[model samples]
Target: MHRLLAGFVSANLFFSAATAKAADLSLDAAPMFNWTGLYVGVQGGYQWSKDRSTEFFTPTGAATGFSQDFQPDGGFGGVHVGYNYQFDWLVLGIEGDADFGRASDGFTCCGGIFTFDARKNWEASIRGRIGVTPTDRLLLYVTGGAAFTDLKYSWNSIEPLFPGVNANVFKTGWTVGGGGEVAVTDRVTARLEYRYSDFGTTRFEWIDGSYEQHPRFHTARTGVSLKF
Candidate 1:
């Protein structure tokens, strides 16, 4: 009976020591993640655009049957500002960015009879952002909202069946896209996102003719941000 009591006491003491060791090695005392802050960043990426145009002139104009489409690819870089609020594993944010570069393409439409040139100097957007953190260091998000850009162009006909026209104007559109981001450091985060912008159609009067453009395009960009 004395031997049995001693064995029970020894077993209890061993278990207590093991539990204490485990407690020291556990992550329960680690710091909780906090991603509530304002951030500013720079981004650079590639964009491919395909824009559609049609005649806005009256039945009396020379362009009785006129249409044009152009596809262009280029690079863009810009800056962005945003705010983020983390709720458990989901994060909500709002951000705005402006990108400037060159996107131009010259093509012949009307069965290669009409020559058209498309040019865009810059673009900007403001969007609502939402994402989920699969891990403490990563975030997957989808963003969308308002987009603005300019469409500048001049198209002339070699045969004069369609008169020459040039226009430079800024238009508003809707954009939507998504991407994944990772926290590279305590105050820095990096991301890659894709967006599709549609400006619908706009009316313009060039020379003696009225015309309209229905434009849309896609963009993919990578950005790095600093949180405050």
Candidate 2:
């Protein structure tokens, strides 16, 4: 009887140790959130532009004494796709996005002698991002790259009575920005970002003369993304 009791105690002790080890293994294997792979998202926000016509030139290339400055502010929305590779606390990624909206403004120069109107149709960017994960689920990053946009300008004069002229320009430039992102779920994330773009100076030829313009803009946007 004593032998049987000893055998039963030994079996119970063995199982108890085995169960404790299994629990420890489970805890050690807990899953962690990772920011790697491809993601696609939609974003929307407001953008404001600052543009200036530095000088008006006659067909003979003589500069007019007047200059015009106009600001166009409006809203825009778009979709973005990107791929991220995470290395420990740092992440590197490439993203592309396109947005369309209206940004229009008009101004009169030289006491209503000359009138100028400007409009923007759409804009896009291809950018590289470098970021750090402050926490497993949060990332802060900076981005910069190429930017493209379409702009239309109209000019009219009264005192001189020059014919109205329209110019449509496609501008290519550079952009830089920064933002923060948070993981809402294992497969979803949210972000907010701001960017500034400069399209440089361009010369547009008109009816009897030409003008020089320098265009740049700022954008603020927010988005939600799905990871794959």
Candidate of highest TM-score: 2
Q: For residues 119-173, write the lDDT of model 2, one tens digit per residue.
A: 8879999999999999989999999999999889888888565888888999899
lDDT of 1 by residue, 1-228 (tens): 999999999999999999998897786776555667899999999988777667755657556476767687789999999999999999999999999998888777658776777778788999999999988889999999999999887868877556787888889999999999999888899999999998888767755666666777789999999999
Q: Candidate 1: what lDDT?
A: 0.85
lDDT accuracy of residue 154 in candidate 2: 88
Cα TM-score of candidate 1: 0.80
| Cα displacement (Å) at residue 98, model 2 | 0.1
Top-lDDT structure, candidate number: 2
Model 2: weakest 10-residue lDDT segment is: 52-61
Q: List the residue pairs that clash in candidate 1.
A: 56-210, 56-211, 57-210
Off by over 4 Å in 1: 1-30, 59-63, 109-114, 156-165
lDDT to native, each model: 0.85, 0.90
